[model samples]
Target: MDGLFLLSSYAVKDAILIRPFSLADIQSVMEIQSACYPANLLEEAEHLIAKHQQSPLSCWVATEHQKAIAYLLTHPWSGDTPPALNTPLPPKKPKSDIYFIHDLAVLPSARGLGLAKRLFDTAIDWAKQEKLQKIRLIAIAGAADFWIKQGLSPVNDKTLSHKLDDYGSDTHYLEAAI
Candidate 1:
């Protein structure tokens, strides 16, 4: 169950594929983000573009019929606190031991096709290959439960809990050991 998995029988034959993000995919990535998230939750196009530029290897995009339909943006990070959402990533690249998942999104029509899970699997594979210690993310949009089911747990550090509040009332910081 790795590398270009079949996304159920509902999709067009061989239409789905996942690959690392490229500078050329920025426009499609923005459209997908807008379609998948509310304005308050969405990152600015400039920030998203900067993230990809900063961590090209960590960001991934999913395509159907060679058209962008979904994406997952990740980066190297440390510490128990997740980065604040919708903000610019730091310019310096660290020798990372942790993989921080920034965003994962799929268009409405692509739901139920297991695209998210596929992207998750890809990230896990990348983390394992990179010898990262853990994967961390801020689970919003009621996605905490979904991450829990995938074996991630809500962080319990009292100090980090305060920082998670910036993401919104229901945001939860989650992590999975590698």
Candidate 2:
């Protein structure tokens, strides 16, 4: 009985898809973002759209029957200022490029389905396409082990020159060579 019978006729695999984010998907992305993050932490759809437009290849969405269920957005990060919401992004600096995973979220119903890893794979592929030197993210509380299992090592905040003021005490930084 490798494949068990189900009461419902519909198959789950047919319902889900992961694809690039489009302008029309912004609202759904925002909704998932709001549900996943705190009010102060949620990035606006406009901001996400702008980034998507600038680098559509770096943004992706997981969909189920054409409904957006998850999203992940990545961008280049330099050592200067942290990329804060609605803040003026500093001019791009020249160097071996590094990618910062700015946002990632999955609907509660869609959790435990490997959607997050798929989104992460999308980011890694984008980094390789752009020839980025590294990929990094700030892991929230209860997620350090998850990131560690993904091969991202915990980095000392002082080494990254990250300001502690913006992040909660439980937040930790992780990085991996792309």
Candidate 3:
């Protein structure tokens, strides 16, 4: 089968729902993560759910036909020391608010349907609504071009080395003003 022909029918026709994430959607989110990534991806879903439950501004999920297909988690960039792995993220600063997009994934079956862009647009809109000055994220290997096309620019400062050892080598830091 030709690759182009195989890729042309991947578009999702059902309505794409973008909304705040809740505990009820955790399992679906995890399933999408498992389908899209090589490694287990829900280690932080529980934490994200809890944080969102406490503060709805922190996370959002995108669904197609009532099934979670993509999700994004955002956290404030405080000046204090970064929290330990798995700890709840701190709140944003008042003067120069910044949101760090910790995770974003769209199921493989749902790729090329504009789901990722929708998720990104939702996050960027939220940040702007909150008067945030910047949105930052680390583009995993193979995702730099996608992010660049979305107006995210690579930052030369420190990288997310501790999260994934290979992150330093494969990931590029990116940020965009909202």
Among these predictions, the greatest lDDT belongs to 1
lDDT tens digits, residue span 64-123, model 3: 767788887666674422334345655535564667777788888888889788888888
> For candidate 1, lDDT tens digit of each residue in 1-178?
6333555543566678888898888899889988977788878888888777777887898998889999999887866657777787766546777788889998888989899999999989988888999888889888888789889997777888777776678888888898
Tell me the lDDT of model 3 at 82: 33
What are the Cα lDDT values of the candidates?
0.83, 0.76, 0.70
**Collision count of model 3:** 0
Leading candidate by TM-score? 1
Clashing residue pairs found in predicted model 3: none
Tens digit of lDDT per residue, candidate 2, span 1-178? 3355451324464676678888889899989987787776666667777667656778899998789999987778776335665454455566637788877889888999999998888788878988998777887746778778888996665744455345556777788888
**RMSD to the hidden true structure, all candidates:** 4.7, 5.6, 8.1
Whole-model alpha-carbon lDDT for candidate 2: 0.76
Q: Which runs of model 2 end up more than 4 angstroms from their true locations?
A: 1-13, 85-88, 93-96, 159-162
Off by over 4 Å in 1: 1-12
Question: 2 or 3, which is superior by lDDT?
Answer: 2
- For candidate 1, what is the TM-score? 0.88
